[model samples]
Target chain A: MTDVVVAGGGLIGLAVAWRAARRGLTVTVVDEAPGRGASEAAAGMLAPVTEAGYREESLLRLGLASLERWPAFAAELEAAGGLPVGLRTVGTLVVGFDDDDMRQLEALHDFQQELGLSAARLLPRAARRREPSLTSRIRGGLLVAGDHSVDGRAVHAALLAAAEAAGVTLVRDRVEGVVVDGGRATGLRLRSGGTVPAGSVVVALGAHSAGLPGLPPVPVRPVKGQILRMAGAAGLLDGTVRALVRGRHVYLVPYGEDRLIIGATTEDRGFDPTVTAGGVHDLLHDAIEVVPGVSELELAETLARWRPGTPDNAPLLGPTAVPGLVLATGHHRNGVLLTPVTADAIADLLATGELPDRAAPFTVDRFEAP
Target chain B: MTDVVVAGGGLIGLAVAWRAARRGLTVTVVDEAPGRGASEAAAGMLAPVTEAGYREESLLRLGLASLERWPAFAAELEAAGGLPVGLRTVGTLVVGFDDDDMRQLEALHDFQQELGLSAARLLPRAARRREPSLTSRIRGGLLVAGDHSVDGRAVHAALLAAAEAAGVTLVRDRVEGVVVDGGRATGLRLRSGGTVPAGSVVVALGAHSAGLPGLPPVPVRPVKGQILRMAGAAGLLDGTVRALVRGRHVYLVPYGEDRLIIGATTEDRGFDPTVTAGGVHDLLHDAIEVVPGVSELELAETLARWRPGTPDNAPLLGPTAVPGLVLATGHHRNGVLLTPVTADAIADLLATGELPDRAAPFTVDRFEAP
Candidate 1:
């Protein structure tokens, strides 16, 4: 019998195992593919300012905190795992092609200022000079030197190593259900007809952490994001460039040895991992528009993966109403960014029976019972 | 007698003198201060895409043509003037912080693509990653990587040196008026009561090109632009950053030994050259919003200069009703970008007695008679 039986093997579950095992807990993480899920295809942008929206201030705060914790987390993860997570602090440059984009950027800047955050405005020339590959038609830009990125693959690899190094067991199999005792989750049942007993159950199964038999339904839906990887000469791009191009959100993330990630097409189709040609075409078209240098890079792979998203776009980080059953799913697009904070929250809860204040707004109680 | 007697020794006048001199014509340029017009305070952006509008296709074509001519023009000016003009083809990045700005930028991109001009869309992360100082609040951006800028003061100095090297005579005095001879305009009268005899008269007086005695009302008026010169370490900004912050056209130009030119608050106060504190405060406030690094730079000087603007916002170039009195003024915000083209048109007219096709649409005859 283990102290904690985690039902997932993605970044969240692995991170939980790593954190909990470091705290002297006997933790076991189960998943069909440990490094799969959205983590395999995400361009981990730890951006609070660019990703902030009108009413998502809580998410912004959480993201910012996670971003702040990333440096120390990565350092510790590397020391523990003996693997480096590709983290780059090259910053971000938000460029506009015309007056309308500039106006929206100004409004965003004003909102940022109102929220007491610092955002720098750049005239067109300054922006282009920084990124020479940027088109000349851009009107102006804003600079957020603090927004950084990490290599998701490296992070996942590091998490795996760290979890292994910390004495957490990884079971490469699908989680069938949670073993319940007196209507409270006690452990996980593997698909191989094996039951693993534990002192507490933690479900960090990402998009699959929903509608298990006799378990409370978590309202996280599968959001399919198609991403493209390109191998290029080093220095094709500096950091990441995100744009709302014709009302569509697109970005280019550069990480590792000249590995460029041009992604991602978001679709509402559930449980689908189809890499549509239209998705690839649109990504390449927009990618070439922003950074013409992308065309010169080699096409590596097109990956389609599922992210678990909640209705309000925030993750459920703390415990559920079911006794001994803690939840850490529905991170959606921010799972990579929220990895550090989520690990801390779940570890603290398992070690000390309490969730931190940062995890308060992200509790599973926000949603109606199903 | 000189073949061309040019009034107003700004960039346009000096460029025309240099071009005409290169074409083996005896050119004389007269002005009270050769580098004291709008050229002294212009952020010489060679942007056809950003400056082009719905009904301003003709100006766009002219600007694009001038942009095409700039590389060779700069090269020739460099060889002739023995000075660097700082023509940086750093391109332009247009960024938006909110939805409104992105929508406007989309419309502009659609319009540009409709006109067969290329504009690329960028996501916010990509933009911020390229420019580190940019705020993450920016929503998205467009890339016009072809648009560029030059050091205006350097261009002016190079133009002066080029004109002098090309054997064009420079008279340091104000022209009283264009001396009309039998309705065919022959020469200019100096303010010191001296008559300058010439084969043809070219009025290149920016902002002050109209309402002189013995000359027809040219329908040009003075638009005062207040600018700030900040002395800082070099590379504070990459190129130029232009913003229509709350619908006001503002920009920052980086040139000359860590000099940043925050400039030219547009006003319709009719030749008022007072550098108001409100203007400087607003400029500094807005400049810091985009590039937080601007706050650390030292304020060197405040400059206010007048630009000659016409009703339709296009320059009055080439021929007027009076045969020998060619018109070359009313270039408002585009004098720096249009300098090369204007020089060619005026020089071609002075040398071969015909205006080029590119300058045909911007002739003085388009205006109503005064």
Candidate 2:
């Protein structure tokens, strides 16, 4: 019998399996398209200061803690997988371009400072001196020196390799249902009508984790995002720049080999994978305004994917009502950002049958059935 | 007696002197400071496309025609002043961040297309591929490939030098009043109690134009703007990023020596030239969204100035009721943009004794006197 069956092969599931196997659990990750979800299209910005907002105080705290884990997570992944996940220690800059925007930024800054975060306000001259190409139109900005980034693609690759190396079986097959016997998760039903018995099961299918056999529908649904990448001369940007361009969440993250990633559109279109023209257009428009230099770079690729979102915009973690069943989905825009924390907590539960205190607030029973 | 006594030493006055002197008119620019005014705080965006709106067709036409004159104008100035006014032909990217922004952008795009302009819609890939640092959250964008920019400080210097080189006299004194003898313009009365007679007097005092002694109050008022400058390593940005960031005009213009210019909060606060903290905050916020790399750059300077604005947002040019007294102020945010055409048209009026057809539409009579 498999000690654990994680119902996904995306970052969260692979990470969980990797950790579970490290704790000596026999684990299997079942995914039709391995490593293809929100994680694949993420900008990988470990931005707690920029991502923090109203009604997300707990998530902000969790994200800040997760950001702390990323450095060690990347180091361990490199040691285990023999490939360095591209983690850059360069900081993040949050900026505003108008009066109203500045007011909002100041409010956020006040909140960040109140939280005792090491966020510093920089005048336009100081901000532009660091990023020479920065527009002089910037009124002022906040510098989050602690906020860093890891390459999303590199992280995905490393997790897959590290998980496999840790004796976690990656089954490239669709999950049909969960086998429930005596009010407990007994195994996973494969799309090919095969049954894999497991002592415990974790549903971590990202945006597709809402419906499962014998479980009520979760509030988790697909929120499609369109992200794009461009290649240019190296060091065009040394770090991440996140901003509310007219109240929109526009971020530019520069990664390995001169690749600049721009994203995403927070959309509620359920399960739609089509990359609409408007989504791509909005991204470019906002990006170019902040970085006029972007209009000169080379176009690389356009991608669209779905992120798992819950009503509260926080991930559901820990156990379900079923005795041996667990939950880890709805990471939303933060699935990649939350991987290390999610993996550790889930592995703890799978190995010791107890959820960590850090994972307690993100319980599965927080929301009603969708 | 000078054929033309320009009652302001800003770019419009200098450009007019340069042209009128070139046409063999005895031109005297009576200005306390020649290279100052709103032109000193300008980003020098020749952007009719981003600036056009309903009821602004004539100004748009005039702007486009002025944009056409820029190349030749720059060459002529370079020849006369021996200074290379940096004119970047890289174009302008007009961006939008969210759905509402996209809708507004699409409407502008539609209007641009209807006007038969060479505006093209750019996908995220194409846009980011070009700039590489552009944020992916841009909902949509249009490339106004013909809309270019010039360095404001360089242009200001060149205009002053070129005007002096073209046989224009620079009278460094404050014009206390326009001497409208027998209800016709004759000359200017200086604050120093010196009278300089001219065949015609052109009021080009920018935001300070309203308080002239004999002129009835036009609908022009002083609108204060704060702009900023930053220095960075070379090749940070290639062009200009203009956006209505949450309905406010925010622009990022890149110039020589890796200087990024961010600017101009449109406020009705009336002649206030103090740089507020909120003003700078908004610009950096919106600008950083498009170019995350900006945070790494250096910040240089913060500046505040007053722009002469009119009710209809168009300049008051050509003749007033006082025959030899012409109105040449109220260029608003477009003063630097409209310099060349304004110079040519005003020079034609001074030389030929009649307003050009293009200048006729922008006469002071178009607006009821306030």
Candidate 3:
């Protein structure tokens, strides 16, 4: 029997398994196809400061904690996996195109200032000076120097490699249900009709984590997002550019030398991964509105994926009602941003069977009836 | 020695070879990859009436002649190839978005009327009645009942099958130059260092027919065009929609049940085939402006190709200056629409050693300094 069994082999599950294995615990991850799902489409923006909201201060703190661990985490993973995760610290520019967009940006800037976040307000000219590819039509923007990005797909690949190097066994199969014996989660029952008993089980199936037959109730829903990947954008922008065109949100994140990820449209439709024409047009339209030079790049690909969303938009992590069962899913749009902290916290619990104090507030019990 | 060696395998060359084979003349076609180049991107708009220009009366006559032969040609080819060529007899609508566009359409309509073409002028509402998917912002339009369309790719595939079925040898090799001997065109020198000896050599390489070694000067320049292919537009438009959006021209041609071709931009950029962001943006912006519903269709593909353009924009379709050398290229934007007439005319010349009367006016000598 394995010491721990992870139900998904995405970035979260792989990272948790790797960390658990490093703590002298045997680990096995089961997934039909690992490193896919939302991890495949994440833009990898670690912009805790820019993404901070008014009432979601706790989520903001969690994002900052993960952001703080990214540098060391990336270095250690690169050394172990022998792969570069394309982490760039050039920061992000959040621009607004019209008067209404500027007003919203101004309000966000005030909130960031109230929270003592490190963001600088910039005029249209100043914003364009930082990223010359930006359109002259932008009204204003905010530059958060602490905000950064990485290539999410690269990170997932590196995590898989690092986890394998750390002696974590990877089972390429689907988890049909939690193998619960005596009201305690024991292992995973795979779609291939095989079972691997474990001392503990971690559910990390992203949007598919909800309503497993033998598991406690988990509140996760699929929030569909349509994104476009473009190429030939080398030196177009120094960093990421998130914009509000009128009232709609759009972002362009430069991944490698000439590849830019333009995204996305948030729809509540469940698990329908159809990349619609309106979604692409809206993304391209707003991207061109913010960065005019994007109109000259090659549209490399278009994809739609589900971000595992919860009611409060914060990830559900740590211990659950069922003994020997853990929850480390529901990262929503911040899955890539929170991968490091979620992995360490969940792995700590899996090894010692105690939820870390910092991660205790994010347990499933927080969402249960008061 | 073979009777004929055609130096391209695109729609024009394939059709001509098939027709010649049907006339009991042995033929061989040389192309590294058959039915590609501009043939792959042609929108297959058979709109001689609507495409009629003021100074292009001769070209208009040629297009009308080809359009007249398309029905019989498609039927015979489909019968021989055993494949449906997706020929739609639904007429074409040339619409206008603004006053300038409307005035341009009106002038073109006047020219068509003067040429005795079958076109009916329609008001905005009447035009919408014809194609309900057209945006209400259309100022006016002209409906040409005689114009029609076909699936260019489907036609090429069918032509390939028909040509092979007619005992035409398809040499999947590139033609390096015309094999000239004793001041007479004999055959073709292939890129594979092989020589194909023939009684006659037909230079049908489209834009690449201009300056081949050992061949007479054929004034064909590559006119770059970028186009878009979309899907999920099964019933978006009843027929083709050719629109003048502001001062720009955009056409939407529906082929199979759900595929729509949106095209294109005319650039004199020499043989560059990079599908730029500006090119796709312009096509999509104008397409959406003309038919708002196009914003909902999937952008299936984006491609750029070069059209063999001539000074008069009319194809050179007869024997050239070199002995035993025939010119059957330079169809420009009308390649697919002109395939039937060009094939019949060129095949007649090859089989009888005399240029057909209709194709005689389009010889390379027409552009002589005399």
DockQ, each predicted model: 0.01, 0.01, 0.53
* Number of clashes recorded per candidate: 65, 66, 0
lDDT of 2 by residue, A1-370 (tens): 8899999988899899998999999999899888777778988888877778788999998898899999998999999888878898879988888888889889988988888888889898988877766667778888899988888888889988998899988788899899999888888999988988899999998888878776656678888888878777376778888766777768889999888898888777787665543455567777777777775564466678899988889999999888888988889988878999999999999899899998899997877456
- The TM-score that candidate 2 achieves is 0.52
As a TM-score, model 3 comes out at 0.96
Worst 10 residues of 3 chain A by lDDT: A273-282
* Better by DockQ, candidate 3 or 1: 3
- Mind giving the per-residue lDDT tens digits that candidate 3 earns over A1-370? 9999999988899999999999999999999999888888899999998888789999999999999999999999999999999999998999998889989998999989888888999988999999998988889999999999999999999999999999999999989999889989999998999998999999999999998879888999999998888889989989999999999999999998889999888899898867766677788888888888888787778888999999999999998889999999999999988999999999889878788888987998988897
lDDT at position A148, candidate 2: 89
lDDT of 2 at A359: 87
lDDT of 2 at A92: 92
Error of 1 at A173 (Å): 0.8
Once fitted onto the true fold, the runs of candidate 2 whose alpha carbons sit more than 4 angstroms away are A368-370, B1-370
Candidate 1, A1-370: lDDT as tens digits:
8999898888899999899999999999999888788888888888788777889999989989999999999999999999999999988777765566667888888888888876788887898788777777677777888888999989999999999999999888888888889978888888999988899899988888898864787888998888888775387778788764544567888899878888787789888766653455567767776776675565567688888989999998878878889999999889888999999999999999999999999997887656
Off by over 4 Å in 1: B1-370
Error of 2 at B21 (Å): 68
Lowest summed lDDT window (length 10), candidate 3 chain B: B272-281
- DockQ score of candidate 3? 0.53
**Model 2 TM-score on chain A:** 0.97
